[model samples]
Each structure stands twice: as structure tokens, then as C-alpha cells.
Target: MPLLQRWRQAISKMSSASPSRFAVLVFTSIIFLWSLLLTLPISSADGTPTRYLDALFTAVSTICVTGLSTVDMSTHWSPFGNVVIFLGIEVGAIGVLTLASILGSVVTRKLGLRQRLIAASDGNALRLHRGAVSESQAVRLGEIGGMLATVALSLIIIETIIALFILPVFWASDLVTHWWDAVSYSFYYSASAFTNTGFAPNPGGVPEFADNGWFLGCLAAATFLGSLGFPVLFSLVRWARDRSKRPGVHVKLTLAATLVLFVLGALTLWLLESGNSDTFGSRTPIEGLLGGSFLSVMARSGGFSTIDIDAMNDSSLLVLDALMFVGGGSASTAGGIKVTTLAVLFLAAVAEARGSSDLQLFRRRIPHDVLRLAIAVALWGAMVVGVSSILVMSLSGAGMREAIFDTISAFATVGLSTGLTESTTPAAQLVLAVTMWLGRVGTVTMAAAVASSERKQLYRLPEERIIVG
Candidate 1:
């Protein structure tokens, strides 16, 4: 039997377990399988076997849609390895529960209870803190089929369109020496950008396309669309098809926060670095503006860069760190606390400051449950970053700035690094690897898996006032 089938058999045995556990298992299995595949001599350019630890880290990063890598992808990996990495990214981007649903659909054309639970939890972005949904809320046969179909088709259509648009640029530039290389690079980068993975096979990466207007345009568009989240994308498609269809609260909040953050980040970067020769100062006016906008787009989870990340001013780095921590929309390829969460958290605070009873956003009254979720996710993420930073500091002897930046990058799954990732020791690297996994898997899911199995209360206890902040 195939290796995947064997894993399937094992996972089936755990069918009775929580969907969160199942999800963690599936992702863990993929990392292990891919790492083993990457260990083969054929996977590397030099015809030598890739080290197990390096291969494992690469597998985790790729599968997590985190672009952090111990290996220089262009020089170290052969075409075969690149293809393997691409496949891993694709699967990872689709997500663990969703991927299982896809496979189950292909094989059985029907889903079991386990598949239904996983699909619903992932599809609706269920917050386990609020507890799982009812059986009826779990995706039905028809809805699951439609959701998976729409997601797959949307990804294919978007990637194809972006790839076609970029192919000519690759053909025109010094980036591609051969027709096949152009084709491959076009497809890979298109998928990578759309998935928010930001793993460019090109050695020079985004810098090579810095002045290429068409390439940058396509890339930015792809990244924006991808980071918008599948729910928002699907809702937009529905609205496009039928005027009566309206976007959900999540979609509205995500788009608004994303737009605001994008402009804010762009303006901040331009103001801070436009005079710094190491960053935007040396570039032309148009290049600097465009480059700053690109950096803004990338700050919210996409890791592509046109300038030296290490050379940025302290203020710019702080701004970027803040942006990266906020990340993209929930259920998107991008990581961090998610834009909606941040937006809601901010709105909640504003409402409290105004002494308003309800947290209203865009005239919609947000739920207390969702506000609690936002608070929990943010606090948990901060704690993870804090602990990871201290660990990196103690293990690798990195200063506060380097430790915080590296830890945040890993935790956000935003691969932009300072000059630190390469020189970090194995313990530091391991810390980062774990941080990447947790960030991608998410604190919400981890919370769900670990939350006690005690029964829900029939009634709440009497409320008591707490101290103010």
C-alpha cells in the first residue's frame, strides 16, 4: 500500500478523537512524510542526501506555509525537490482538515462523521473556546461538496491567471534563462504569492522583480487576494453572481482592517525609510513608493521583499513587527492573530472607552463570544512570542531585538528575517521550528485540543466585578 494510505489507516484509528487532534496528527504526518522524501539524494542538486534535521525543518516550514528555511531553495534543491516543496505548499495552503475532506470526497464521494466534523470546524472557522458546533451546523453533504469545489476551483483559476500574466515578464527579464524555467518560475511564484507562502525559487527573489511593474503588480494582486481568506473570496464571488448576496461580518471587518493596515504600513515605511539610503532612499520616487507599498502588503504575512530587511530603521522594524503580528484574515493562508481579530479587539477597546454596551463595527453589533475569542487568541499569541523570544535569547545569545524579531517572524509564519536565521544554533532553530508549527496550526486549535473534556455548564455562576485596567 502507498505511504499515504498507511497514514490514512492510522488516522482512521483515531477517528473517535477530537477534530483538533486529528488535524494535528494529519499535519504531523505530512511533515514527517515530506521530510523523508526530501532526504533522498534525488531531492537535492548535488546528488547528496539532505540532512534529516534540515529536511525536517524545511518540510515543516513548507507544509506550514511558513517560508522560513534552513536551506537556500534555489541552489540546494533540484527541480524534483522544488516540485515536492510546491506540492507540500499546496496541501498546506488548502489546510489539514480541508485536505482530508478533499481526499475523502474523491475516494468515497461521501463523508463520514469525522470528516464532517473536521470540515465544519475548519470551514466556519469555529472557535473552540466557544465550543464546537451542533451536528446540524457541521457541513452537510451538499455544502461540503460545494465549499471544497469552490475553494479548489478558485485557487486553480487565480493561480492560472496570475501565472499567465507573469510568464511574459519572466520571459522578458534576466530571471529566467530558459522557456521551461520561465514557465516553472511563473507557476511556482504565482501559487506561492496567492498562498501567501512567499517562497520564490529565483535566487534574487522579489528584488529581481523590483522594477518590473507587471510582475510586481501581478504578485501584489495575487497576495492581496490570497490573504483575503477563502470565506471572503467565496462571499465576493457569490455577491458578484447575485446582487442580493451580502458579505459576512468577518469578511467586512477583514477587508476594512486589511485596507487600513496596508495603507498605514506603506505610509509609515515610506516616511521612515525613504531617507535611509540602505532602504528606499537610493531608489527612484516611483520605485520607492511602489516598494514601500509592496513592503506594506508583505508585512501582513507575505514575506517577499525588495529591500534589505536587516538594514531598516528601528521604527520601521517595530511597525513591521506589529503588522506581521496582526497578519491576514482568519482561515487564510497567512498567519498571526488575524486582521478581524485585531480589528475586533481594537473596536472592543474603543467601545469600552466610550462606555458603550455593545461593540458595534460597521453598524453591526459584534458578539461577546467573538470578542472573547479575539482576546484569547491575542493573549495566547503574545505569550507564545514572549516565551519563544526568551528561549532564543538564552539558547542562541541573540539580543532582545534579534530574538523578538526572529521569534515573531517564526510565530507569525512571516518568513522575513533579520540577519539572524542563518547563524542561529540548532537549539534556536528548533525553537523557531516549533514556533512555526504552532503559529500555523494556530493557538485556537491548540486550545481546543487541550481544553478539558468536562461537560458544559447548564447555567452560569453569579457575576462578580473585577478590577479595571
Candidate 2:
């Protein structure tokens, strides 16, 4: 009876806690538990023991969707470890809040207020306003789960079909010798590529076929699709299904902005690396163009690369830093400030250029709250990257560019590296880990937690202006 009373009290306390604090507590607890599970000594196929640090690193990487690895994933982990990683990616990409909501629906056959709040915060709700939808929360959660399952299953099926065609090409070129190995390799590559988790199972890392025009092209396309965010993909599908009806302005602007970024990124990389023989090295003009195009698309979000990132010229590295900073589409698998946020900021800049007070895109005015959120995300991301870079540089003695690149990779959860992660110190690794966690949960959630304790202002202050730049 005493124990039951204590349990009820605990539940009451949790129920009364601020949502942001509750979220953080839940996230931390889950991550710690997962880390502990991974830290247990696990045997690989060859009977080699996995180290605690390696396991912890891998666990953090999987949970955060950050691909920095202290050890080779393919050779180090047994099938069990691989399964753990696969599950981690699924959960991490789907998000903790969404998973909780789904689980709540399954267990209770209904969704509570807490679950609905989480769903809204996760961007699953069609309208942010309370009581905008008449359906039960359980229905909404079930729909979200169904959507996730359908998307994941579709990705696997499509990748498997694509792999069947790709395997023959790999086999013909002697890239993969055996059929089973090829199949496993193809499946792993497809999963890693789609999740933007850059962990390759290949013994030699990304195979030489990565340099092949067709292979690079296919991989780039797959990564781009994966990084474009689920919300945007669903929107596109719905719009396509109902083409007679006009698409939302957000959908139109997202697609336009995506194309613009791709083109601009490609041009920047081409011009920056045109003279560098190491990255564009000794290649025919066509090859250089192909490589540059691939880098432009892949560097922003996906971490896979045909060319050695470490070998790139300084100018090219700076270009990559910029692209990585901007990142992929909003609400997508990829991370960064997000393309939509950047688009909004760009539109805001244009509005200022036109000497207009209102920011507009696609003939639609963006809400001030949304603009503030975008700025907050950008600021937080930049600060995380900057602070992480400082910590890494201090600990590892790595060059500024290398440290910056690694920090951006961690914060964006892109997983691309210039060969610095392998040599980073323990302290530096911790910094990267924190950055990954922040990048995954994002700035808005963190900001919410910090502001939760502050009381809301019931009265408005008179408007005042400071000097502008």
C-alpha cells in the first residue's frame, strides 16, 4: 500500500511538470538506459569483445543520427549490434515524442492530453490551435504510426528493388565478389544511405564504385529524397494526387527553395574546387562536374562521398561548411538550420530589400512567431557548432577548419568527416555527443525548456527600436 501510494505521487509530480522539462527528463533517461545496454560487453562474429566506449559512441550516434564512429560498424558489431543500430535509427528518425504517442495509443486504446500535446509539438497536427480537430487523439496517433510504417516499408521495398539492379553492376565490376555479401552490402548501404547515417559495411569503406557516375548519381538521388523531410514528401504526394487543387504555399516555396539551393551549392563547389587536383584532381572535366554535383547535393545533409573530404582544397571546404550549415528540408531526416528556415530568412531579407515590413513567400505572409522560431533555431545551431568546435580544437589540437567541419557535421547530424573524429580526445567526443543530441531534438525544444520557468508576460511593453546594422 505504501509503495502504491509512492508510485501515484511520482506520477502526479510528473504530470504536473512543465512539458519541456518532462521531455528533457524522458530523453535523458532513455538515452542513458540505451547507453547502459550498449555498454555491456558484446561478442562479435569472430568472438572479439566490443569495448564500452565504442558501444556508447555507437549508441549515441544511432540515437542522435550522428554518424561519427570510433570504430568501424561493419567489422566491429555482430548481427545483434547491427539490429540494435537499425532499431535506433528507426526510433531516432521517427522521434521520441511520436513514439510515445504511438505507444500510448496502442496500450490505452486512447490518447491522453499529454500525448496530443506531444503530437502537436512534433508537427503531426494539421492545426496548432487547440480543439481544431474533432477526432480523438488515439486516431491521430494511429494515423501517425501508420504513416511512419508505410513510409519506412516503402523505403525498404524500393531500396531492395533498386539493390537487385545495383548488385549486378557491382558484381560485373568485381566490386562485390559473392552474391550473399552483395545482398547484405546492398541492404546495409541502402539503409545507411536513406537514414543519412553514413555507416558503411564495406571492408574498404565506400566501395570504388562510389566514384562511378551512375552509382554516385543514384546514391545522391536517394540521399536527397531521404533528407527532404517526411512532411514535405507527404505534402508532395498529396498535392500530386490532387493536382487540380492548388498546393499550399509552404509546399510550393519548399520545392522552389530546394531546387535553388541545389543549383547554388553545385555552382559554389564547382567554382571553389575547379583548380584543386586532389578533390577535382586529375579528373576529366566531365568527371569533375559529376563529382562536384554529387558533393553539392550530398554534403549538405548526407555524409556519403566518393571523393575524399580530407583532400578537398580550403575553398572547397569552406563551401562545404556553408552548405552543411544550411542543411536539408525542414521536418526531414536531415538536420541543420534546415532549408525551410533558410528560405524564410532569405525571404525576410528580400522583404527588407523591398523596404516592406511584412515578410512574404509564395504570396503568403509568414507569421512572426514562425520567423522568430527560425531565427532561434539558426542562432542555437550556430552557437552549438561554434562552442563544439572550440572544445574540439582545444582538446585535439586539430586545425580550425577540421574542427569546424567536424562540429558542423555533429550539429547537423550529417556524419561526414575530414578524418578528425578518429583522433579526437574523450572530452572532444563528449562535446560532439552533446551537439548531436541538441541537433536531433533541435533548438526550439531546448529553448522551451529554458523559458518554461519564466512567467509569461500578461501585458505588452511599448515598442522600442535599437540601432540597426
Candidate 3:
């Protein structure tokens, strides 16, 4: 019970725990504390004080960068609470898992042996294989630091520029009274939309511009860019700088997958909503096309909307659900199973159809490890979304469709909602909180904590044949 004894016990426990697991635990704990602190009656607001569950939900949503909310963020929380939410968005965008690892390294002066081993196991860092290219711990850490700094600065600069362009428009339209208020609101919405954090200072989301073509287009572009993972963006940038060389496999695959999904999602929405008077009804052909295209892009990871999501036809809703579930790219600000994982799965499926022994993309064979990890991450993501949906439905008595929509939103860290979130019960809120947390950290990382204890098998087991559909 003594301070030294407590410190010793804490160190001993940490030493015994898997470093990745410890990192997740630490970050998760911090998020919970931060959420509780934000919910307390510590700031001045006009509306009712946010409940603990609501605050926690917002915190998890912000930290997970999932925008599902059980309370009206604009009405319930004060300026101080909004600031806390903004901080959470920044932290979540950078990834709490990596943040924890970085902090651990800073405190310890080096990564623990377990941490290095786990990083290697995850294939995030490369070890020398017969004198091949190898990275040192310092280089790895520097890469992470560089990536974070680049992303953080990019978000700030992009948001500032967007706010400047938007604030004047709002002022001209009389949507905002003062220059400062207009700037503040523009920055908040722009940051939220770009990060896919979905925390809006305006309750109805972007206000009168919700139906404006140019404004929606700008937001759609920003959201799309933000949702595309940092790795893909960096790779493309590098390839651009070196024009003779082709883009990396991940970047190429991400672009292809994004295009396919965007086209498919747009077509599905357009077709499904063509006859529905509520969404695409009686609109010009070009307008319909634009709306569908915007929805397709936004649904993937961005939560911005031009039309009310609640008014979409069932089929369109289902299509949006599927798109949200698939989510954005890996190593990016976006959530979900990632475009790379889905691309790998598609390639694997194609290979199976062709009776090929190896999965190939762009004439290059995919590594078995990469393929396996992709499948594992996808399966885990599906399971998390499925279970979370069930829990929400049972607790709140919301319909399956609404629950599924919210669950996908949470798991993908996309903040689009079908209006059920604000009325969700406390228990359902808690379940969603967990889903957002898991979605952000990723199921593989969480599963690794339990599976990490088992040593890697030295020998492969005999292959067994099984019947397939």
C-alpha cells in the first residue's frame, strides 16, 4: 500500500504484460478519464449539463474519431467541452495506440524487448532477412513521429484554409452574425468533417449549406482526403516526386479500390433513390448524379451529408451501410477494415475463381502474411459491428436497420447517424463506446494482447482439407 511498494507492483505488472496490450490499456484508461472530466459541470453552457454516459459516448466517439453521439453536441456542451472534444479528435486522428507506444518509448528511453517483438510480429517494422533492408528502433520511431507531425500539421493548415473560404460565405448569407463566431464555427465544422470526427457546433450539421452543391463538394473532397489513410497519401506524394517510379502496391491498390467502391456506391444510391420522392425525387439528372456521387464519397468514411440520411430509401440505406462498413484506408485517419484489406480479399477471391495458387495484384504476388492479416482484420471488424448492433438494438429497442447503421458508423468511426443515437439508452451508449474504442485501436491489436502470450510455433502443422461452398 506504500507509494514505493505501489510503484514496484505497477512496474512488475507492466513488465509482465505484453507491451502492445499495456499501451492500449493506458490509452483507453486515459480516454475514459478525459471523457469523465469533460462531462463534469466544470464549464458554462446554456443547455442541460451532459450526462456521464453521454459525455463518455462523445469522448469515445471523439477519441475513436467515430462521430456517433447520444446527445446534441452543439446544444449540450459548452465551449470548454467543445475544446475537450476537439483535443480528442486530434488525439484520435493520430491514433491512441501509436501515441501510447510513443509515450512508452519516451519514458523508458527505448522500447522494451516485448514491444519490439510485438512490433515485429505485427509486420509494422522490418527485421533483417539475410542482410536485406532493416530499420533501427530510432528510424522506426522517427518514421512514426514524422508521420504524426505531418498529419497533424496538414489537418491544421487544411482546416484553417477551409474555414477562411467558408466563413465569408456564411457571413454573406447571414448564417453567422459576427466574424469571430463565423470563423470559430467554420473551423470546428471543417476540422470535424476532415477528421471524420462528426462533432458539429451546428446541431443540424453545416446548416443552410447542407443542400448547397459547391459547399458540399468542398466538404466531400476534404472528407475524402482525410479518410484516405496517411500511408497511401504519403506513398502517392513520394511517387509524384519521383515520376519515373510507379506508386507502391498499397497506394495503387487503394486508388483502385476507392474508385471501384465510389462508382458502385453512387450507382446503387442513384438507382435505389430514383423513384423515392424523399431523396432524389424529381431532381434534374445532373443533380441526381451529383447527389449520388457525393453520398458515395461521403459514406465511405466521411459523415457529411447533403440530403437527410433518414429520408433515404431502404435499399439506399443498405448500400450506404455496406460502404460504411468497408470504411477507408489503413494507416490513415479513417476507420473500418481499410481499402487495402478489402482489396486483398477481392484479389484472393479472384485468384480462387481462376484456380490460381497465389493471389496476385498488378502482376505481383501478394505475401501470404499480408493476405492473412487482411482477412483477420476484416473478420474481426465484421464481428465487432455485428455484436455491437445486436447490443444496441436489445438495449434501446431501436430497429435492426437503425442499430446496424449506428454500429457501422461506430465501427468505421464514421459519424453519420439515422437519428437513433440521440435517443439511445445508457447501456446501448456504453456498448457503442466499447465498439468505437475497439474500432479505433483495431480488433487485431486487441486480440493480440490475449494471443501474444503464446509463443510463435516453430513448425507448421499438417494441412487438413475441408469442404467449401
The number of the candidate with the highest TM-score is 1
* TM-score-superior candidate, 1 or 3: 1
Worst 10 residues of 2 by lDDT: 130-139
Q: Supply candidate 3's per-residue lDDT for 95.
A: 58
lDDT of 3 at 418: 87
For model 2, residues 1-469, the per-residue Cα lDDT tens digits are 6885676556435633544455555555666766666654453545555666666667777876677888777677776667677767656665544554454444445556665555445543222322333332212443454445545664666567656655655566665677877777777666666667777776666647756666666677777877776655655555567775455666566678778888887877877777887777577777777777888777767788777888888878888898888887665667788787788788788888999999876566776555666777788888888888999999889999899998898888888889888678877877788887888776536534432333557999999999989
Per-candidate TM equals 0.92, 0.87, 0.87
The deviation in Å at residue 176 for candidate 2 is 4.2
Score candidate 1 by TM-score against the native. Answer: 0.92
Candidates in descending lDDT order: 1, 3, 2
lDDT of 3 by residue, 352-433 (tens): 9999989887767776655666777888998998889989999999999889998888888888888888777788888888
**Model 2 accuracy (lDDT, Cα):** 0.68
Tens-digit lDDT track of model 1 for 1-469: 9987776666565644556766777788889999999999999999999998889989988998878888888789998999999998888888766765555444444576556556555645452334544333223334665556667887899999999999998888776778999999999998888888878898978887777778888988988888887767777776778777667676777889999999989888998998999999998877788888999988777788888898999899999899989888776788888888888888988998999989997667776766766777888899899999999999999998888887898888888889687678888999999999989886647434433243678999999999977
Window of ten residues with lowest summed lDDT in model 1: 133-142
Give the distance in Å from residue 418's predicted Cα in candidate 2 to where it truly belongs.
Answer: 1.2
Q: Which wins on lDDT, candidate 2 or candidate 3?
A: 3
The lDDT values for all models are: 0.80, 0.68, 0.71
